[model samples]
Every structure is written in C-alpha cells, then in structure tokens.
Target: MTGQEENGATRKGPTRALVLHPDLKSERRRRAPELALAEAVSLAAALADLAVTGAEVVRLARPQPGMLFGAGKIEELKARIEADEVELVLIDGPVTPVQQRNLEREWKVKLLDRTGLILEIFADRAHTREGVLQVELAALSYQRTRLVRAWTHLERQRGGLGFVGGPGETQIEADRRAIDEEVVKIRRQLAKVVRTRELHRAARRKVPFPIVALVGYTNAGKSTLFNRMTGAEVLAKDMLFATLDPTMRGVLLPSGKKVILSDTVGFISDLPTQLVAAFRATLEEVLEADLILHVRDIAHPETEEQAADVREILESLGVEEEVPVFEVWNKIDLLTLEQRAALLVQDARTPGIHTVSALSGEGLEALLDAISTALDDRRTIETLTLGFEEGRARAWLHEQGVVKAERDGDEGHEMTVALTERQRAQLERLRQG
Candidate 1:
C-alpha cells in the first residue's frame, strides 16, 4: 500500500521495477537462456501488478564479482531512477549481498533480484496457514543472505547480524543467529505440514484411485486445463506463477471411474534453487501420480523448448518415462487453421497426443476418453477359483469382483472371479487357508 499523490490527483503507488536479463555466459546465470528473459519479463509484470506503480527493463552486463552491471550501465540506470523517483529496482537474476547493497547505494532505491520478487509474490499470494509457512521458510532462507536498505525507521539490531541493526543488538553475528533460529522453527513447522500431507496421501491410496498430475511450463495453461478438467476455480491466469501451490480434486472420467487430478506448480526453466527446494512437498504430488498430463501451449514461440525444460524438471523430480504420460497440446484456438492442421497431423502420429483448448473447452472429451482408456489399460485382471467350503471368501468375491458363473459339486463349489490383482492375491491366500 505504498502510495504517492500524483499532482494532487489520484494517489499512486511507490514501487518502480527494473527488469533485468542476466548475461547467459556468466557463471551466475539464474535459468536457461531461452526462458530466462521471457520469464523475467513475465515475473516483473506480475510484481508490478502487486502494487508497483511503474516498471522498466534493463539488460545487465555479464556477471562481474563486484558489480552486477557494468559501471556505465549503473550510471545510466542511476540517472533514470533519480529522474523518475523510482522506489525499487528489480533484477531478473540473483544478486549477491554485495551486489544488492552496492546497487542500492548507487541507485538510491530498494533493490531486489529475481528470488526476492518471487518470494514477494508468494508472500502476497499465500493465504492458507500451511502455504504461508512454506513461503515464510523460503523468504527467510533467502533473506539470511542479503539484508540491506533497512527502511528509515527500521532498526538495525545493535548486537545481531551486520545486516540489521536493532536496539542493543548491533553484532551482525547475533542477527544471523536469530535468523537461523527462525529458519529452524519454520522448517520444523513445514515438516509437520509435510507429514500431514503424507497422511492424506495414504488415505487416498486406500481408496485406490489413480492419480493424474497436470504438469507443464509456467503459464502453459496448466491451471486453465486443470479447471476445465476438474471444474475447480483455483486461480487460472495468463501470468507466470499464477498457481504456486499444487491443487488436487477428484476428476470423474467418461466411464464413471474416479481419479485424482493434481494441478501442480508449473515448471520454469532455471527455476530458482530455493524455490525448488522449498516447494518439494508440493511437487512430489507429480512423482506419486499414476499419470502425467503434460499440457503445453502449442502456439508459443518456444513451445518445444518449454517442453524440454519441463522434461528436465520431471527427470530431476524422478518422474521418469516409466510413468504414463499424455501430451496435451493446449491453446489450439490460438493457432491458425494451417498451423493447427499441421500440429494436429504431427501430434496424431505422436503417442498419447491430444489437442485441446483449455480456455474454450475444445476437444476436452477426447482428452477425457484418452485418460479413461489409459486407466483401463493400467487395470490388471486376475482370475480366481474358489471352493464352496470357503463361503466367506466366496461372498467377499461377489462383493469385490465380477463373478462370471458358479459350478456346484457334491464336495464343494467353484466360482470364476474376474478380480483385480490385489483382490486375486487376497483370494488366493484365502483359498490356501
């Protein structure tokens, strides 16, 4: 709610964003070169939407140990900030404590890098208690490094971390220790959250519903597709990182079998290390899924590249090719007739390929059918032979499996049961007894 009056007219906010692109050649590159710039731009805009009034972009010189950008570029940016009365400068790449402090001093504005911007976004978006805890853990983990530009009234501890000087706590060492203590507290709380989630997962396993995780590049229409499929309104937006947390709901297939559909946080090339680690609990939903629906924005210029990036992330997450996958070429409505026809033909030959417009609900029935068929194929049929003496087992078979027929005999009775593998195993154990 930082605001400034504009010519005594409507009040305006104080935030000013400076979007940056890290030189790919630098050892400090934050993400893949192809996605880094575009992601940075998207994040900057999203940040501005979070109460920032004005925004601008700057290309930083390749990472130098001492300075983030070259001296010449710094001078030019400083002038702009001064003239525009900029209150904040947002860098698209990671900035070391030294770099952040130096930039703030030179530019005379609050400076934040890609990590800070993302952390800020999470801080703003997190509503649930668990979600807030995760975001706080990440923010604290990040802030433990860079702590400069203490607002005018904010105290720098007298005996704490050198970054913050609070009354009677100036020692930077003490501040670091305090921050470390808080980090431990947050971690413990998040660990509890993870355990709670694990219990929920166990409950789901007992019900034995197949899980299909919707995964793709950020802003690749994953949320849109998820809402279309599950009819949940979990924030579908055209902005990057619109959906941070993973969302799960029951999706009934055309055959009337129920499956769990989890819309997970979208993958972005060069995703921040801190974020990946902090959000591991949420992402593991993908790992446990029975199938992965890789929804892609087919019309994006970097669609293929984005797909590769998502694959890399999946690999890192241990979601290997062994898990069933279906590729959903989304946003078909955005394509021209010629391009759409070409993609339709090309994707047709690709296994598990389907086209759909999540926004417009186009071709969704086909996708659902494909999912139902995939689930059916995963179901293994087990044959069972039961003796009449085992009447209890026979009765259980009737409850759990589809019985074909019954043959009666003087000694006992036998029945053929088409049951699932688990049911068959149980029945076999019963027969042996």
Candidate 2:
C-alpha cells in the first residue's frame, strides 16, 4: 500500500480498481457504450484516490440471474483482473445481492454496483452536517437489504429469537433492524434541520434579492460558470460530483441589481432514488429560484442524452412548469471553428439558448445582459410615502439601493423606488408585522 499524508496522519492509497459496463447490443441505448464505459472509468477514479487499472465495455446478449455474467465471461474477466492485479470491480449497473455474492466468491474480489459506489463517494465528500446526515441516511436505506456482504458481521448472532429459528436472531435481521432504527433517528434530526433551513430562507426573503440557481448534468461546468459569475472560489473540477454541498454567492447583474446565485449538486443519469429523496431539501434552491440556468456540456458526444436526463430529474422533483429556465451551452472552447459556428446558428434559432465558454469568457456579456433583462422584467418603479414613523423601512429601501429618488412631503418622505413583486410583498409583510 502506498502511504500519503492527509489532514495530518498517513493514509493508505485507494484499491486498484477495474470498471466494466455491460453493452447489450440487442437493447436500445440513448448513449454509446464506449462513452458509457469511459464515464464508468471516470466515476471509479472519482472515488477518493482510487486508481483505475483497467476499464472496458463487455458485450452481452442478456444478463444471468445467478451471476450477472455467464461462466465463460466471468472467467475472461477473472483472467483480466489477475493480469492487472485489480482488487476492486466496479460494475456500471445494478447487481442483485445473490449475483453480487456469486461474483465476489468466483473472482475473490470486492464488487460495487452503481448505487453503492455513489453512496461511497457521497459519504467521503460530504462536508456539511446536513449533507453528512443525508448521505448516511441514504446509505443505511441501501444497506438494509444487502446485509449479506462478507465484511458485515452477519455471522455474529443476537440473543433470543422467539419465532421459529435454527439459531437466535440472524446477523442480517439484526443489522436490518438496527439500520431501520438509525434511519428513523436520522429522519427526525433531518426534519429539525429542514425547519431551521426554512427559517433561514424566510429571513433571506426580506433581503429582496432574486435567487438564480445553476443546475446541470455532472461535470458540465456549472461550478466553473458559477465561479466566473460570482467571483467566488468554489470547487471547480472536471471530475463528476466534485461539488456535493450547495453553495451561494451574491452577484451584481449588468443592470446594477444584486442577486443570489446558487450552485447545487450536479445531476446524473440513473441517480439512486435514495439520493434523490435525501437531497430533495438541498435541491429546493431550484424549486424556489426566480430563474434556473440549465448548464450543458455542449462538447460532449452524449450532450443531448445528458440534457434529457437532467430535465427528467427536474420534473421528478416537481419543478414548476411555469418557472423560467435558460439553456447555457457551455464548453464552446472545446469545439472546432466549424462546430462553433454551427452551434451559434442553432443557438440563434433557439429562443432561450445562450452559448458560452466559461473558461475563455466568450459570450458572457450577452449572457449577463440576458440575466439582467430577465430580472429587470420583474422590477417596477413605484411612488410610495413612508411616514417618519416608518424610518426603519425607509432605511431598508436605501440599504437595498432601490431608492432612486426621495423628497420631504407634508406627512412623510415621498420616494420612487424600483422593487420586484417579491420585494413588494415583503414590504407589505413588514408593514403588517
């Protein structure tokens, strides 16, 4: 094992990993098998310090129930793993518990399916308390059914099973019950966290800034675009799931209006149901956003499929049908001159499409102008008389830089200020209070 220092102590390097994607030629696929295999390799590499030794797409007419792959195919992969000295096999699809156990016993190697690997990545990368709790909850939900993994202490029996049993409580049953209890505790704690988060959002509502949310498929350059727009040093990497927790920063639009830009966890095709449910509270930023920026990795070969997946997840989360969303075609710098021109033409024909390279800063001015226009459309200049007794409200308007002009009136101060519908509603709420 290779030793490296992290945080203060030495840590062992990750296990050597082999990745495989099952390519069923008889079945239809939205994305090419080669691209899917490459993505699988990337996902394997993304897991903390993992070294991907080899990766390939295995052609299959159909999967075997006993072992995902046939005996001949298993021997072929076993030979490859031995040749490469691979300790871990990461399958880019679901594996039933029996199939997983059989494969592990046959190859004498650890196996992880897509969902299990994702949970591992999330557990390693989560930073915030809520993020940590959510990942744990999702992981427990996943493990409740798969307690037969050899590493689990299933051989250790519990005391006394009143029901018909050869021995006492089996390890699997005990583990399942323990996981269920832990899930209940986590849900209770998470509910309290959610309530506190709602309180924070309610407090932010009084500040009168429109929330603009950034969302996209994994590694589509959303965080890079967020850094460019907000001038904040958010983690921006080519790796998938690099940004796990949500990040928000205030930015000034071209029209001199300040707005909050929120960067959220990237979406992936076939995202685990448990993760989607657990991260729903984190994704509420999208549901509550005044505008959503649907960033796209335009240069990717599977860009259309990825975009479809992103839209599917958004709809699954019950994003409002009427919420405004803008398509941001990113990574224009990776395209050839001819491809760039073709994209520009297509973007021109599209109603809400904006083409840009977040790295090179191309077409950002027009994008910023579009954002300004979208937000400005909601703002209105209105004349209002704030009584001297309402000095606090007058001060708030001034602090928000919404007061364009003001004058002393007979009873109070008369002012004309630009305000959004949300801002006006907040003002009314403040007065009512």
Using lDDT, give the best candidate's number: 2
| Candidate 1 local lDDT, 1-433, one digit each (tens) | 2343468874554355555565645365434555566667677665433333344444544566677778888888788777866666767767888888788778866666777777766655566567778777776677666544332112422111212111222346665677688889878888888889878776665566677899998889999988888888899889877887778899899899888999877787667777777777778878777788999999988888889988988888776455778999999999999999998898778879999999999889988988998877765644445556689877765654356677876666656644443345556677778
Q: How big is the RMSD of model 1?
A: 7.1
Error of 1 at 11 (Å): 6.8
- The alpha-carbon deviation from the true structure for residue 173 of candidate 2, after best TM-score superposition, in angstroms, is 1.5
RMSD of each: 7.1, 7.7
Model 2 agreement with the true structure over 122-183: per-residue lDDT tens digits: 76668887888898788777766676753232222211110101222246776777777887
Whole-model lDDT, model 2: 0.83
Supply candidate 2's per-residue lDDT for 145: 61
Question: lDDT values of the candidates?
Answer: 0.71, 0.83
